[model samples]
Every structure is written in structure tokens, then in C-alpha cells.
Target chain A: MTTAEVSAPTTEKPKRDKPMGTETRVAWTFIAPGAALLLLFIVAPFVLAIWFSLTNQRLISPLPTRFVGFENYLGELADPLFWKSLWNNFRFAAFVVPAQTAFALLLAVFVNQRIAGRVIFRTIYFTPITVVMAAAATIWVLLFNVNGLVNGFFELITFGNFAPDWLNDPTWAMWAIIVVSIWQGVGFQMVILLAALQDVPGELYEAASIDGAGAWKQFTNITVPGIRNALIFVFTVTTILAMRLFDQPTLMPRSPGGPLDSTRTTMVHMVDLGFGRQAIGRGSAIAVIFFVIVLILTLIQRRFLKEESAQ
Target chain B: MTADSDVRVSAKKSVGANPLWRWVLYSVMIVLAAFFLFPLVYMVASSLIPDDQVLAKSQSFEAFVPTPFVGLENFSDAIERANLPRVFANSVIISGLIVSLGLVVNSLFGYALARLRFPGRKLLVGVVVALIIIPFEALAVPLLFMGAQVGWLDTYQIQILPFIASPLFIFLFYTFFLSIPRSLEEAAMIDGASPVEIFTRVVAPLAKPAYATVAILGFLFSWGQFLWPSIVTRGVDVRPLPVGIGVFATTPPVSWGDIMAYTVLMTLPLLVIFLIFQRQFVQGVASSGVKG
Candidate 1:
């Protein structure tokens, strides 16, 4: 059957080699709608982003737009709020990526065990990922209230000494967002890592145990290397998501990027400028710069993954 | 034996072999589960009670339980005050359009890229793959500009159209189509089936998993979409549920019970779908993670 299947396609290779006939026409016709949308939405907008960044454009301005090359970029860099927003993006990714990754791996490992009701446990763990971020933020805003459940728990645990206003206090506001982000995001990474964990051959664990390897040692030597690609993938994806933080911060805080701008991510900043302030040129510059930062981070991650795999 | 001990015995060869260690693990898991579940449970509980009682009960364990139950008044109030029924309809229409239209367009594009011998097929695939890395947030400003320029802003098409032809979904369908055996298509060709017919009959049926993955992901994405909709949509006319609920939550004279009710109303549909299709949801997410 395998030989027959292999030969069948090759047997018709002569007829398939003809260029730009009905096949090409049919293919292009099939592809036209999606291709047009992609070009219009993605490609053209990307090109316009660069062009708009170099001009003095406003969402609604009386003055005609003109070329002001790199001024927008320079002005954005000079602004302290832009730096604060960029730092917040980095700060968010810095905490969320590692913390969420570790928690997810822990949950994955726990659910990967042969314990009964592990499926139930996994389903419960992954429930948050299915909840819309806006709803999740709304749910959490109540919990993060001054006299809310979280503070109630803290008061109980700390004997009534340490309950802070979570979303209002500048010191605690970013941490509140970070905690909510991790709580909401960890399940997604856990699900992926759990799949990867299942793919790691059972024999490897059995073999390691037979060789008298301890659990931690087996994890580092066997399990880590086994799911290395997945680990890196989860890390990179989580980092990208953390950098793109918008919805939670937008919805959870007293205002979008409020509590003295404690959680103003770059995406939130770009939106605030482009739409809220109507500074389209500056917003476009921020968008372009943000894209470059994410692109650079992704490239760096790819190179790092490549080097690690090469070794 | 209790279910816990049954789990312990069944998992003997597993890491939780020793009873003491098993107890510890179970304890930790129970704590974690409570931590994960308490907020959601509290939201539901709060949604069922009066607005005043929600904050009053927060300091005690009673917060997790519905007390002085006002029944579904909060939900009704949420619907009335937030104009939720219209927002709900808007969300359903927008997400439905995106998911349905996306499946057809992306799947067709993917199928062509996978099977057809076209002039720029390789280049198109590469471009799609490259496009996947460009986050939508980066393009939102320019897209907004373009939307405003062409008067596409504050319209359903602005939200639905930009997202319908996703590079990631296209690539997902492309890869899935590639994995279908060549012999099946060859046989269909021998039977005098056109490319379109072959896709509809032979190929699409086999690609149900791919379609399900895309549909679920697309619906979830479109339904939960916050930034883009919040940008383009200025009125409740075309505003989806997430942004509606968000604006409702932030508006003054806040009622925790009503907000929770709104949130539950926003979240319940997806949660029900998720529970029913939990395995597919997990597998879809996992496969996307692994492949992408």
C-alpha cells in the first residue's frame, strides 16, 4: 500500500509540471480573499506604520501632515512616561514569564502523575484560560478592592496587620496586576507543558529510577532535556504575551494605566497616545519602536534556543 | 476507602507513592485549587446576593457562599442597566461572523498552499509564517488610521475583517492539509473531481479537527477582544460584551453584584463550551503551542 501510494503521485508528475494552467488559476482564485485581507489589514498597515511614524500626523488636526523624520521617535524617547511604560512592559515580562513558567511546570508535573482525578485537577486549573480577560479583570477588581477577599485573606493570615489597598496603592498596584496575570495565564502554559510532559517516554523515567537517580536529579537530567523545546516555546510565548499586556491593566486598575502609571505597558501607552491623545504620529512611532523591541526579543530568543540546541 | 486513598493506591508507582508524601501533595493541591477557585466562586456568590452584602460579607468566609440571596435580580439589573442583551447580541454576531468566515477563507487559502502547484506558493507560505511574528498591537495604530481614513472605524467590518484572515490560522490549516495523505487526493483526481470538489468532499471532512481548533480559538479571540474593539467602537451599537462589561465595571455608582453578574454573563457561555469540549480545548491549545 505504501509503495502504491508513493508511486501514484509520481506517476502523474509529468501532467503536474505544466506551469500557470488551470492549477495556478484555481490556486490563486482560492487564495484571493484571504490574501487580499492579509495585505490590506497586515501588510499595508505595517508599511503605513513606518510612514506615519516619520510624519507629523494627528488623528484629527487642523494642520496638514508633513514629513518630520525621526522627530516623533526622538520626542517619544525624551518623554519620561514613555520610558516608564517601556519599563513597565519589561517589568511585567520579567516577573510574569519566569513566575508563570515555573508555576505552570509545577502544575503540569502534578497533573502528569498517575494520581486519580488528575483530569479533574487539570480541568479546574485550566478554567481561567477560558474566561475572557475582561471578565477576569472585572472579577479580580472586586477581589483586589481595599476591603476585598484578598485583603481579607491577608488580614487573616497576618493577624490584621498587613492588608494594603491593592489596586489603589502605587506600590501594590503593579503587583496586583502581575498576580492576576499569572493566575490567569499560568494555565495556558501548564496545558502546553503537560502535553510535552506526556510525550516524554515513560521508559526514561523508569530507567533513571532504576539507576538510583533522585527525583530532582531525574527532573534536571532527564525531564528537562526531554521537554527542552517546549520549555523554550512556553518561555518565548509567555514573554511576548507579558510584553503585550493591555487588557488586564486596562480594565483592572482605577483607570487605564492609573495608580500613578504603575502598570502602563507599552501597548497601553501607544493606545493612549494614538487614540486618547490623538497624537497619531507619536503613537505610530511608539508602535514601530514597540514592534522592533518585540522583534529583537524574539530574534534573541530564537538565537538562544538555537545555540542551546546546538550544544 | 476514600477517593483520596484510592488515588494514592492507584498511583503507587507514581511519585506520590509513600502515603505521607501523598498526603502532603494532596494538601498542597487542595490549597492551590482553593486559591484558583475562590475568586470565581466568590464572584458567583456575590452575583447572587444584594450589592450591599457583597462588601459586607467579604471579611469573613461567608463571602464564598450566597447569603440573603436576591436571586437573579443582579443579572436582570446588569442586563437592564448595561444594555447587556444588545451587547450580547453584538458579541455573538461579531464573533460568529469572524469564526465562520475565517474558517472558509483561511481553509481555502491553506488548502491551495498545501496541495496546489502554484507560482508563488512557497513565497506565500514564507510570508504567512513571517507575518505570524508581527503582533497585532504593533499594527493597531496604523490600522486605526487606515480605518478612520476609509470610514471603517466604529463598524462591525473593522473588527471582523482584520481578524478573519489570521496568519497563524492560515498556517495552521496549511500544515494540517499537508499532513493529509497524497493518495486520497490522487484517487479523488482520478475520479474526475475538481480541486474545489475534492476539498469539499474528501479533504474538508478529514480536516474537522483543524477546523474545530480554528473555530474555537477564533471565537475565543474575537469574543475576548478588548483593545481593538475598545479603539474602534465608540458606541454601544457595535460594542461587544467584553468592552461593554469593562466600561460598565468602571463607571461610577459601582455595584459589585451587578458587575459580577455582568462578568458571569459574559463568561458563562465560553465556560460551558469549554467544559463540554475540555479535551479539544486543551489539545487545540497544546498543538498550537507545539507547532507555532
Candidate 2:
């Protein structure tokens, strides 16, 4: 039997009844602008990028470019800088993915309780999501300065002189960027998790309480299990964001990576190679590699989330 | 009977007694909330002070000082230095155009995916989802070349056109359309309504909330767009506020005070939008299963 025979008629329809005459033409007319824009901007650019990746084309040189086949890819594959930046991006993802998930989940549970001034707290927590990237980075640059607010606060608390310039020092630059990312990101994930928490049934919590479970036990066994779907969602999204880390380090007047190229993320490297240096072929190769990596990770995450939801 | 009553009374008493752990939990939550809010508060407070006293180390309570205040001096300076009035106008026009155009395209595509049976529907949806993961930087170089070739460079078409059919918005609207009851549209069809009529009269009215959700998200993304406009525009004439502020912030004299003021200026419109639509943004965020 064909697949169509087994499906309901509603699901098995294969054609649209063309609303005849001028209306049908008009409908297409309405869609023409969008269709044209998508073709010109999205589809055309994607195809062009693929073609450019296979040729040695520089943005500055207007001469006819020669097709190099896979040479660009080969060059990127052998470059040590590519490997180092790729490794750094993965490391950043590893730290951010787990830490952000745990922090967002914990904060969601804390705020889930029916406490006084709940709305106010929610607003306060989610305010950072609205902040522009430039502004946020500026504030962070000041705070992470040796004599700025964060270090000054640390000294006050410890009663010892301990101040390291966060964006300047190689040892701390990546971590510093990661910290800013988390501060910017935590609120968004928190809101998502909180929504998930609200959606979970309250009877399960009441039953756990009646069974003489402590707060910690209830949270670990009941709350965690209940919001597993949300936890997976947060992990996948944050992984994507962390892999695309660019603006903070890019805005710094120092090296794109800052302090011995410690903060050079893969995306930043690709941008510099393509736009700044005008090596389109090499940059396209990097983008393709980066795209492949993200694809594999997203597939893995989707599979994990699917399996968890199946339970 | 007396023994049963006493047992019930004891049960009620135990239920009424709040746990000590809950108190500590509330206190911890409050502290966490305060900690997260501190930076935003500090940013706003610092922007209110005169440029002379901004980083002075003399006044210990400088950020919190309400007296001897300079009102909107930083705002005026930031506006003057950054040419923010022009940037704000540009941002508003770009965001408005994108959102308006995006709504039309997404609605049509969403309806096609949801109700109309067409060839390659599943394939199209899959492509949209896959497009979500392709980072914007991947296409930046070719997109720039395309813009140059088409004479769209430094134009509104460059800023607004590419963003019109966001995969995220298409996915969002598609899901929303699927959830609407088919019977309503079916009835409309039976009553001699065309697909367009049914959509405009029935589905569109019912889908207001979803449209609002997409509109806000689209507007916010366009407003905060820096990387694309930064490369494409190349000057202050067509730059959005985020990139405009970014360029101005990097310019000489390095006034943290003016930067803060400009930051506040850029942030104020968004804050106002959020305040006015607080419930919608919150509800929209909750209903949409995706994170920013």
C-alpha cells in the first residue's frame, strides 16, 4: 500500500485549489516582494558564498578569480590558527553550556515560589536581556578594569589587594568574555525555565512534600525531572550562542582575542579573514567548517531532547 | 469523636506552620535578584551625574547621590556627539519597515504551510528550521558583495530586506497557525469565502497575539542589529543606533560619561517599549519555546 492510503484525507491532500482568476494572480502578487527579497538576499548569497569558497577571490582585487577547487579548505585544514580558535570555541561552549543551564534552572526554581514582590524580581532578573551589546560591553570593560567596580568590590570583601585586568590579561580574557556572556545570557534562559516551571503541575510537588521530602530532595527528584525538557532547550540554545561569541572581544581595542590572542573566537576569526583581510575563499572555508560543527551539535541536541521527551 | 477532632486539629496546625527553610529560600532569592539588578541600576545612576564627578573616587556614594544632580546633560552631549537623533530616526524606520514587511511574508508562508496543501511543504519547513542554525557571519561576505552588485549598499533595502523572512518568525507563525482550529476556516470556506478572505477575516483576527509576538521580536532584533549595518553602511548616515553608538563610543576623548549617556539614550526607547508592553513581551516569551 502507498503511504497516502494509510493517512487521513486531511493529511494526505496533495494540491491546493487554485483560487482562480485575478485573486490567485493577486495572491502571488502579494507574495512577490518577499519572494524576490528572499531570493536576492538569502538564496543568492548562500549560492555565491559556496562558489566563492571554491575560488581564490579577494574583495579588493577586481580581477577574474581562478577556481582553486578544494585548496582553500585544505589550507584551513592545515592552519594551526584555525585549530586553536576552533578548540577555544569548543572550550567556551563546554564551560558555558553546563554552567548556564545549571544557573538558569536554579534561579527558575528559586523564583518559582510564591514570594512577595515576585513580579519585581522577575523584571529585575530579565532586565539585562534588553541591554544593547555595545552598552553592555562598555559597562563590562569598566567593571573588569583593574581598578574598576568588580575588582574594587573583590578587594573590599577580601581586605587584600587583588586586582587583575580581566580583558587585558591573557590568562583571564576568555574567562572574562565568558563571564560577560553569562551575565547577558542568564536572564533569557531564566525566563524560559521559569515559564516551564510554571507549566509543570503543582500536585507532584505537594505529593512529594506529603512524603516527608526535604526542600533539596524535592527539588532534585521532582523539580529537576519535571523541567528536563526545558533544561535541554536551554542547553541547545546556549551552546549555539556560546559558539558564536564575537561582539565583546571584537569591540575591545586590543587584539580581537586580547592578550596573546587568547579570546579569538572562531566566528571572530572568520569575520576578520573574510571582511577585514578580504580573503573570501579562506574565510568561506572557515565558515563552512563552523557551519558543519554547529549542524552536528544541533542534531545531537535535537536527538537528546527528543529521547528525553519520549520518556 | 473527640480523639478524631484532636487529630484533625493537629494536622491543621502542622500545615499552618511555615518551614524555616522557606524563609532562608526567600532571603536568598531576594539577594540574587538584587545582585542581578545592580549593574543596570549602576549604569542608570552613573549616567545621571555630571561628567566632572563621574569617576572621581572622592564621593564614595557617588552612584546613589540624588542631590547636586545634573539632569540630561549627558543625554544632550550624547545626542550631540553621536548624532543620535538621526540614528534614532533611522532605527525606527528600519525596524518598522522590517516588521511590517516580515509580518506579511511570514503570514502568507505560514498559511501555506499550515492549511494549503502544496508540494515540498515539509521540505520548505525543514529548510527554514535548518536556516536557524546558520550563523549570520557565514553569509556576511557574499551578502556584502551582493549588496554592492545590486546597488543596495548603504540603503534601507540592505538593512530591511534580508531580515524580512526570518526563519525563526516563519517557524513561530507556522506553529501558531497549526494550533488554530481548522473548523473555523473550513466553515468560512463552506460559506463561499476564499482562502484569502478566510485568512484575513478569520485567521488573522484570531492570530493577533502571535502577530504581536513576532512584531516585538522582529523589532528588537532589528534595533540591536550591529554587525550587518556596521559593515554595510560604513558611515553614520544610515547606521542604526547600536552601531552608531558603537562607532561614537570608539571615537577619541573616550568619555565613559558620554558613552554611558548614549547607552542610556539608546536603551531608553527599548525600556519604554518594554514597560508599555510588559505583559505581552512576558507572555510572548513564555509561549514561544525558544530563547533569545
Best by lDDT: 1
- C-alpha RMSD values across all candidates: 4.8, 4.6
lDDT of 2 at A174: 79
lDDT of 1 at B150: 88
Model 1 clashing residue pairs (backbone)? none
CAPRI category for model 2: acceptable
The regions of model 2 sitting more than 4 angstroms off are A1-35, A253-255, B1-19, B58-61, B66-68, B249-253, B290-292
Who wins the TM-score comparison? 1
Q: What lDDT tens digits, residue by residue, belong to model 1 across residues A1-311?
A: 44554454455657756644788789999999999999999999999999999999998788999999999999999999999998998888888888899999999988887677889889989998878899888888888889888888888889989988988888888898988888888898998999898777666666677799988998999888888888888999998898899998888887899889998889889999999999899999999998898788778778877887699
- State the local distance difference test value for candidate 1: 0.87
With a 3 Å backbone cut-off (N, CA, C), the pairs that clash in candidate 2 are none
lDDT of 1 at B180: 81
lDDT of 2 at A70: 94
Per-residue error for B173 in candidate 1, Å, reads 1.1
lDDT score, residue A300, model 1? 73
> Where is model 1 more than 4 Å wrong at Cα?
A1-20, A308-311, B1-14, B246-252
Cα deviation of B53 in candidate 1 (Å)?
1.6
The weakest ten consecutive residues by lDDT in model 2 chain A span A1-10
